[model samples]
Target: MTFQAGGSFDIDAWDADKPYDERDGTKLTRVSVRKTFHGDLVGTSTTELITVESSAGPVAYVGIEHVQGILHGREGTFVLQHSAGSEDGTPGTQWLRWLIVPTSGTGELAGIRGVGQITVTEDGAHTWTLEYSLD
Candidate 1:
């Protein structure tokens, strides 16, 4: 739960939520900032369309990302928080997924790199908050 930034982070009540299974579940969160180098970051990504193998996987979920608003030398990437789990209100009792990876390239970022974390809550949603710095 530590980011690669040069300082310590104390995120205060940054709330985020999504609808699932005909209900809205509330979640608790915390973040450790790794980088805060300034610049506007703009990019897109795609998830690997996963299918339920057993009685696992989410019933439903949505992606609400926070793209890093920083860059350096016209190069940067993002860490997509591909978090998923069973929409059944029970956590640690099921298989939850936390996939963290760097964003693909284009434009000012031809071959940039970044790293971040993805957190999954038992209430039926997840969060992805990452930072990007020059390589």
Candidate 2:
């Protein structure tokens, strides 16, 4: 059966650094993220976000997040892969999407498969909805 987990998260820490200049005023930046989640899913996640930036704006980014926590009382861990892009920073133009890595689930969540979506409001309120099923 499929289940839904809804929750909010707070960015506990974000460490970013520019390691090199690719060219044309574009730089390669690496960021480490630590977040704490609340509500239906409870625990913390550590993620690495790599962003490609130019003089205009951020061209693209890819992130891999390891989520460790309890979902609806099941204790386990999983991974989420994030990919997104946007240069103009226009509303409805920039997109961020995350998906579960196949067979990455462990513990009680072994064999879990699903997709998740995240939304961040202007006030920095982050929310997530995960639709998933467990084997």
Candidate 3:
């Protein structure tokens, strides 16, 4: 079975630093983010991301996100793996995939698997939709 969860989140904290420039003209940067969610689910999440920037534009990034909170009254914790990219800086040109780590769910959310998408509006509001299931 599958269920849908929709919500908006606020970035409680964000810190990004440009670490070092690689020899291949790719600049690598590290970013840490924290968020608080509201709507069908209420919780907090922390993410560690490594962004790769190429000469053409923003290239790709991979990150691990740890989320703790309640989803539809079920409390638990889980991890999401992030792999996403943008070919160019064009509007609506970015894509992202967030996958729930196998067997990473805890509490009532144990055995959860899902995929989610996030959209940031032009005004900077962040919204998310998650299609998931729990066994």
Candidate 4:
């Protein structure tokens, strides 16, 4: 059966490298981030991302996040594949998505699979929604 989870998370840390590649007006960099979740899903996660930026602002990013803790009451771990982008570097034009890595669930989370999305509020708060199922 499918379950829905929703929550907000706080960014605990963010470490980014100087642009490793720059050309014209675009640049690429690597970033590592840590977050703590609250609400229906309670956990901590570490993410590694590759980002693209332009004069307008952030253009896109792809990442992998490993999360550990509890979802509802099920305790375990899972990995999320992220793909986010903006056509105009504006919130109205951006999309932040996550795909639960197949077979990456451990412990009580085994066989979990689904997709999720993240929303960044204008004031910079981050919230998420997930739809998933476990075998």
- Measured by TM-score, the strongest candidate is 4
lDDT of 4 by residue, 1-135 (tens): 999999899999999999999999999999999999998889999999999999989999999999999998999999999999999899999899999999999998989999999999999899999999999
lDDT for 66 in candidate 3 is: 95
Candidates in order, TM-scores: namely: 0.34, 0.89, 0.91, 0.98
lDDT of each: 0.37, 0.87, 0.88, 0.96
Cα lDDT of model 3 by residue, 41-81, tens digit: 79999999998888877778899999999998999999999
Candidate 1: TM-score?
0.34
Clashing pairs for model 4 are none
Q: Which of the predicted structures, 1 or 4, would earn the higher lDDT when compared with the native?
A: 4
Candidate 4 is scored at a TM of 0.98
Q: What's the distance in Å from true for residue 76, model 1?
A: 7.5
Top model number, lDDT: 4
Candidate 4 deviant stretches above 4 angstroms: none
Question: By lDDT, is 2 or 3 better?
Answer: 3
The sequence of per-residue lDDT tens digits that candidate 2 reaches over residues 1-135 is: 999889899999999986555877777889999999998899999999998887767767899999999999999999999987775654346677789999999999889899887776777688888899998
lDDT digits (tens) for residues 56-111 of candidate 1: 33443333333343343353444444454455534554443323344554455434
